[model samples]
Target: MDHLADSQRVLTIGEGDGRFVAELVRRFPHIEVDCLEGSSAMIARARARLPSAAKVNFYHVDALNWEYPVEIYDAVVTCFFLDCFSDKTLREWLPRSINCSKPAGKWMVAEFREGVGGMERLRSRFWLRVMYLFFNWTTGLEAKQLPNWQGLLDELGYGCFEKSETSNAMIYSSVWQRWENARKTDGFNP
Candidate 1:
């Protein structure tokens, strides 16, 4: 969360149970945060984790239908959240979500990814498939595979400037910033 220390305002989409938000507020007490979560039970659990004095606002609403404020946040975060949806959903949702941030705002994402090559790739793909199957069977999740997040981010005019990955490259966390001259597309206005 060091990358987010300088942010004055942040938005977290699908911030499940608020573990990351709690840590973020602990480390950067000065940053104000807004959490958008769809589940009431998850929101209640998350609310219970933070002290009453924490600077957080919880919005219990479906993320896909929520009205995002324009140019309001300094950073937008998604941790293990975006992977729950299909690429078609992400293409329609991500732009609207990112548009809530300022023109130069940062987008931080933490999620599972397929490895680059060799046994790592094989192992990652195996685990990802298992995860998809399990989640689909248990929760009726629609996504069957990992989306091309890198390509989607590129198309949306964001560039990854910082990243870290596990040894197997099955999981990754990345920080991205929109290009200075990037055009706002997909019906989202700057």
Candidate 2:
């Protein structure tokens, strides 16, 4: 949220139960937010959580397929959301996510990361596998493992301005800022 202190328009994908959105609306009264979530119940809960005067729009739509707003948002947030996608799906959707933001916009992500080594790596892998199985069975999620989101973000010309890890490197949060040169060289207007 600190990375987005100056943001005016924000987009949040998979804004689950609305805990984050509720606080975000309260803290940043001047900012407008568009929140996307697939579950109807979650959307209702999110709506109910927000204050009456909050400047927020809720969309009960799948993030992967929803039409992007096109280079308008000052910041894009996807907390614990991107891990649900396979590499193929991410390859298709990530660019759309980027294009939804302005040329020099901020992108914030928080999700599970594959651990580096030893016991930590084992623990991470085990839990991820369990999560994959459970989500696949329950929600029909496509990804069997965590996607290399950092790699894709780097390839798309985003620089990690801030990052932190916890749970023995099994979880990470990062703030990415898009580079001007990257957008120009890549011809990624809009």
Candidate 3:
């Protein structure tokens, strides 16, 4: 977080309960973070679990209609928050979020990328579909495949020059550095 220069203004789209978000604020005491979450319950909880650091701000906002500051962030991160939307909503958000992202900025997303073993696959699929039916309808998310995000970024002109994965490939995350001209010459050392 300290490495990010423009992260002085950081935003989390679905920042529920400030605990996890507070971790970032705690680490980067000088950096300011603004979190947007739709659930009042979650937001209240977040306000309570405040990080030790005082450089944090909170807002009750939805993922789709939330406003972005005129200045972009140096880094944006999503953890287990992207899979809840439908394909249409995902499509809309990808572009909007990419726009919110800064040039040469880092965007990281962590999500469940693969179905589980045999029977578990079927069960997970059923639950995944159910989640889409229930949550996406309310949240206005367009159902989408997890890996398709790479293509979405490419379509929006991000090359995803670096990436990483964990949990036996079932969970993955990638950091995309955006550009307006030539693609940025960036890659993760890891």
Candidate 4:
């Protein structure tokens, strides 16, 4: 939550077991999240495990169809989730992700990172591709290069405020803030 600019509304779009968002709320008691997840089991577990679940209301629904409540959140988070969509679905999800975020609000993403050459990296990438194809076909996710997340944020017109790659390069933690509610229709300035 320290990554957040200040005390404001926050929502976790693809909140899983609600673990990460839960942590966000824990540290910043003022932070609130309207967590949405498609999985019921995960949602139940998250509800049970979260210390701040009372503060963090949750909604169980598909991210693509769920209503975004019209510019209410100061931050939108899609951690380890967006990569599950196909380009078409990604396009849909992105706008909604943006919609949920208030003007000048932040968008944060935490994703698995395929590190540089090594047996570990090679194996991880191979499995990730296979998993993406399987899930993409099953769930209709894009499943391609969701890495280089900074690029993804830029391509969507969200400027990167700060980012960090895991020591093993196994994950990327990113925060991007939109300049305004309306995106440029093209992408980033650069």
Comparing 2 and 3 by TM-score, which wins?
Answer: 2
Error of 3 at 3 (Å): 6.7
**Which candidate has the top score in lDDT?**
1
Off by over 4 Å in 3: 1-6, 115-147, 179-190
lDDT of each: 0.87, 0.85, 0.65, 0.71
Question: How does candidate 2 fare on TM-score?
Answer: 0.90
Backbone clash pairs for candidate 1 read none
Each prediction's RMSD to truth? 4.9, 4.5, 4.2, 4.9
Per-residue alpha-carbon lDDT of candidate 1 for residues 30-68, written as tens digits (9 for 90 to 100) = 999999999999999999989778999999999988999
lDDT of 4 by residue, 25-131 (tens): 77777776678899999899888877733578889898778867877888788888876654566665666656666667777788786767888789778877787
On lDDT, the stronger of 2 and 4 is: 2
lDDT of 3 by residue, 57-159 (tens): 7677776776675446767777767766655666887776566756766776667665547865676667666765676678675554443666676677766
Candidate with more favorable, higher lDDT: 1 or 2: 1
* Candidate 2 deviation (Cα RMSD): 4.5
Of 2 and 4, the candidate ahead on TM-score is 2
Question: Where does candidate 4 clash, by residue pair?
Answer: 85-141, 85-142, 86-141, 86-142
For candidate 2, what is the lDDT? 0.85
Task: Pick out the ten consecutive residues of candidate 4 with the lowest summed lDDT.
Answer: 181-190
Candidate 2 lDDT over 1-190, as tens digits, reads 7667788999999999999888887888888999999999998988999889999998989788898978999999999888988888898889876889988888889999878889888988899899999999999988888988888998898877667899479789887777663344333332
TM-scores for all candidates: the values are 0.92, 0.90, 0.74, 0.77
